[model samples]
Target: MNASSPIGIFDSGIGGLTVAHAVTRLLPNENIIYFGDTAHLPYGDKSSAAIQAYSIKICNVLLQQKCKVILIACNSASAAAYELVKEYVGSKAKVINVIDPVIDYIDHHYRGKTVGLIGTKQTVNSNIYRKKTDALGKDIVLKSLATPLLAPMIEEGFFNNNISESIIYQYLANEELSGIEALILGCTHYPLIKSQIDSFYKENITILDTSEIVAAALKKYLSQSSLLNNLNAYIRHFYVSDYTQSFERSTQIFFGEQIRLEHYPLWE
Candidate 1:
């Protein structure tokens, strides 16, 4: 519960590294402990009960590490397990999810606008963003599409090329996402292919960068709570429940560097 304690972040896979990298860049003095549940990735396809169970387990691991704050960095987990984890963590640590910050941003800036969202099946089907916006009682219209292929494709290192562009274009071209003022990259993995997506729209439509928005929200919370670290040196730890060379190598794509990953299996 102190400023020096590391910030905990977890996702179904390396996609969460995008948020981890943003946090590191924004708060270099603060320590970070990131966990990727590579053993059961693409949580987009898993049941809500299963996502809740896995999220609680991951939070337990982060709590054991004495994390001062825990972030559900995956959209699927945020949609399915945020409330459960917050209740389970209780007073042990602060809990933040990737969805709320973006929602808040939209509420403040895009009221009465038609916004589009593209995410995994789990996130889109959950209708979290739609429900949250509706609760605001604003004139916001949200159109959501389940871009299930994008996340897995990014994890496999398929982006910044013709193959990736074609898929990106195909998804963006869908009638469901048309006529929107902006598009939300609802999945963290989508940021890896953000440039391709950006090129697809040619900057005509705004593409929300969820990681940066979430990072700013984290900074604001720490500053307001007096939990901001002032130290000059800090350590960053990356852990995965299960590991493969591909996951290890893909760290650079998500994290902006070739950081070492420690294998820490939750099932064992």
Candidate 2:
């Protein structure tokens, strides 16, 4: 809750690094402690209770590291665990979820327009994006499709390849996502293949990526709370519940550099 404390961010896997990169760019002086639940990759298929349990453990690890704020960077985790984590953290730390900021963005910018969303099964099943956006009374029409394959594909370093392109085409070609004014890249991993998705529509639709939105939101939150760090104190730390060379590789893909990941095996 102070200016010098590190910001915490966690995701099911390396997808959240996209958010981490954005945060680093936006607040160059602030430190970050990132946790990737590599042990529980593809949280989109897990039960609500399981996701919450994993999220709480990750949040506690961040708290133990003296983080002042926690960002749930995974869409599935945000949908399943945000409220519980918010309540658990209480006043110990501030909590931010990826969904709210994107919903707010749509409410402000795309009102009265049909917006398409593609995400993991848990995210689409939770219906959080649709419910929140619709409740805004902005006359926003939401059409969502569960994109269960993209996350794992991105995690496995399938981006910028023909295998990735074919998968992206299959998902976007679905009739459910057709003819929308905009498409929400509802998973953090989606940004990694943004060009492939963007190529599908040929600039016919606005592709909303939450990495920048969430980063801007964190910057604003820190500024409003008078917790902006002005010193040359930026430090980056990456942790994972489990480790593999693939996770290391994907981390490089997202962050554009190899970060030495410390294994913080939560269940062991």
Candidate 3:
């Protein structure tokens, strides 16, 4: 409710750090508290109920930290648990999701255009992008494919090499994603391999930057709501429900630098 309160951002794992990084770069003065539910990594495979439960638990932790806003930075969690989180956090803090800002951008810029989307199985299967685009009545056609391997690959630091390139190429070459004017990186983790994806496309097609879009949206909301932090000095805290050496190492890749991560097990 106040300008000095930190923004809360949560993902199923390190993938959401992409969004966290973007927010930090865009709004350096705002404090941030990030939670990675590593105990339940890849919400993509979980049922809607499970995602909802984890999201609410994370939201409660963020709210306890007095976060002015809570951002669901994972596409799978956003698709499955956004409404529930929003409703649960009402009056306490604002709740935003990664999907809506991209959808709004598409509505404004890509009307009547064929757009391709790549995400985890849950995000793709949830049909969130297709459904929302259809509701726009804009004649926009959305093609989606589930690239289940990309997140785990990126988390394990497998990108920017031959193995990563081959997998990226194979996914992009899928007929389901062909003939699209733009591709939405539905998963936050996709941005890490964005250069490879651009290389595969030869920069011929537009690759939507979901992190920037979501960050900009957050900025707009904060500005309008009088919650934009103005102080130069700020603090950041990173938490993971479970810890692993790989997750610790991958933080640098997603967050753009080395940062400490505190383990805060929700079930305990």
Candidate 4:
């Protein structure tokens, strides 16, 4: 593949759209192909081995599509399957995950702040955030809550419905997120619930979106590798293990603008 080839990105589900959108905004001239494994959404409950298998499958599919670089846009998959994909990508392609960049961003920007994390059970248990933040020499007081329901709520097209709002409200009610100066939306899928998060963060706490940090990291990698694509070209292709209207609704929620999306199957 040439340097001008499009980058491939994938997530367990619609969560990856956040990363894809961020990369597009930063590198508008480059083309992107995104895959969402909606057939097996909410990877939190699945075993690590299962997630790794799925991640490897997605990487192979993306490579066959002629992608020069791959982004494991899902946090769960990144924690579980990044090494597997890295082997396949080798020197020919680079693989970027969404975690390390945000950790670096928070370490540099908000030193010694109380950082609260909300993600899947697996992500919280992985402690990648805690380890990375501590490595930057900042004493970060990290409190994590396993927001298992948020993914399904958003996936089912219930952003503002009774269940979605209730789940979010319940998580915040008894829990003491008060000392947290900033909250990290640890899961990519959580961005769709941004409105509720913003409205609830009226107590002067800052909510840092991981997508921004991921985009900046992606730019740095492209520049360092001399793979920055700038040509008279622009295109984006979307794929899903199973696509549904609910996926479109979730995309619209995160993108801030509706996109004409074409669905492709990855299981073939």
Candidate 3 versus truth, CA RMSD in Å, comes to 0.8
- Model 1 misplaced regions, further than 4 Å: none
- Residue pairs with backbone atoms closer than 3 Å in model 4 (clashes): none
lDDT of each: 0.94, 0.92, 0.94, 0.82
Q: Which ten residues in a row have the lowest lDDT in candidate 4?
A: 259-268
Q: Model 4, 88-180: lDDT tens per residue?
A: 678767888988888878888788778888889878888888887877888887777888888877776778666787789788654646578
Best by lDDT: 3
Full-model lDDT, candidate 4:
0.82
Query: Which residue pairs in candidate 1 have backbone atoms (N, alpha carbon, C) closer than 3 angstroms, thus clashing?
Result: none
Q: Return the TM-score for candidate 2, rounded to 2 decimals.
A: 0.98
Better of 1 and 4 by lDDT: 1
Candidate 4: where is the Cα deviation over 4 Å?
Answer: 174-176, 256-268
TM-score of 1: 0.99
